[model samples]
Target: MKRSKRLILLPHCVLNQNAVVRDLAREPGSLSGLVRVCLEEGLGMIQLPCPEFTYLGAERPPMDREEYNAVAFRQHCRRLFAPVLEQVTEYLARGYRIVGLVGIAASPSCGLFTTHFRSGEGPGRGVFMEEVLAALEGEGLSLPSLDVPLGYGVDAEETTAFLARFRAFCGGHP
Candidate 1:
């Protein structure tokens, strides 16, 4: 069977900034730069579920990891991740090479290396990220994951740095 060269898991906000809560989106009603990069490189991309949006809706108040770490929130994340895990597993079984899983840095529910906590930013994975990692572990699978913040605006320096990091995470160009 034919398989895609690479698979990239992206947070929902990266594709649909308008779905984000409050004024936190960097590119409202448009795709983030990261998504554009993936498309240009022809990588198979998957937009993961947004636990926050699913639970609280688009108009919900912005919150941090501390607030989203509750049992109910965690349960919601788990539920949201189940189908995602299944899809990843199917892709792997089909011999699709998953380059990496990309998340939103400093997000309360989707961050990988940085998370929003206690009204501030901190070093840690977000609630939904935790569940995703746990599901990957349960399946005995491991893949490189990185978090790229989306609210960094369109500054040239910031965009360059983010592209560099993303390229590095993908193991060089494309």
Candidate 2:
């Protein structure tokens, strides 16, 4: 059988709630609904490293984007994404289509937009995502991206909206 040759970059917590900060994990397991859609669409998932978990560990307190925006943390994001960048390039070389990135909407380190801050949620890419985008940009590559809000799956309505947006991102024939 022919391979699907399609992929999507994802933050680790999306696939592993175990990596989330204790109080913030809303799901009992992986986001099954999201995963189901991806599988149905034949989009392979690239689970990126959990920068907060790896840098601060699972037991650490919830932190915000400003707190994680230190020199060392930024450095770590760069180091951690190196191999992922290589993997993306390899897939590109092999003719795989990277559909886009799916990021947590309210994360401190992995949010693509609407990140947490000491004050409250605000708009911006999380620390780790900044590095990922920069690295990809340096290589002249960019992926269309979307965010699954923290409230995702809390209601059928929200989930429906995200799925619709996801389908549009996946594209279609002219």
Candidate 3:
């Protein structure tokens, strides 16, 4: 019997972590190289979250949430992730069984384990990744997500190892 293809979902911030997009109409990134690697490793599917979620409004407000309304803050997050959620749903519908998910390590919007906040600085925490994972879990998707926290530095070897690990998890030969 033929083995079912595996899918991987990753935030687009993985391509460009430091840049923010003020214009929503602009196309976000060309993660072609990364995608190529995935294909080369025998990954059958790849899903990318909407750029807006990772870029459009990534920075935290100048002041703490105490200066912002809870309703507005929640609204901001929902709006930013709206497009991403839509794309994620679409990917899931395409018979893509999520094998792994990758997220930035410390982005207020896309980090998986650490994100900056307004208060005296919260410990390693990324709201975006947490939210996305929760949603995926709600839908019964099982996938391992790795959060690489290097703010602006890309260690090619480490990243390659990370991807290799994901491939191994998916039954791909190391």
**Per the 3 Å backbone cut-off, how many clashing residue pairs does candidate 2 have?**
0
Instruction: Kindly list the per-residue Cα lDDT of model 3 for residues 51-152, writing each as its tens digit.
Output: 343333565333322333255544565565556666657767976566677765545555566555665434454555555666667667556766654522
Q: After superposition, how far is residue 123 of candidate 3 from its true place, in Å?
A: 5.1
Q: Write the per-residue lDDT of candidate 1 for residues 1-174, one digit (tens) a residue.
A: 644468888888878887888877777664556776786666888888889888989899999899999999988888988998989899889778788888888888889999998859989999999999998999998889887765455666877788877876766674
Best by TM-score: 2
Better of 1 and 2 by lDDT: 2
> Cα lDDT of all candidates, in order?
0.82, 0.87, 0.54
Preferred candidate (TM-score higher): 1 or 3: 1
Model 2, 39-73: lDDT tens digits are 87878889999999889998999888889999999
| Clashing residue pair totals per candidate (backbone < 3 A) | 0, 0, 2
Q: How far is candidate 2 from the true structure (C-alpha RMSD, Å)?
A: 1.9
Q: Which stretches of candidate 2 lie over 4 Å from their true place?
A: 172-174
TM-score result, candidate 3: 0.59
Give candidate 1's whole-model lDDT. Answer: 0.82
**Models ranked on lDDT:** 2, 1, 3
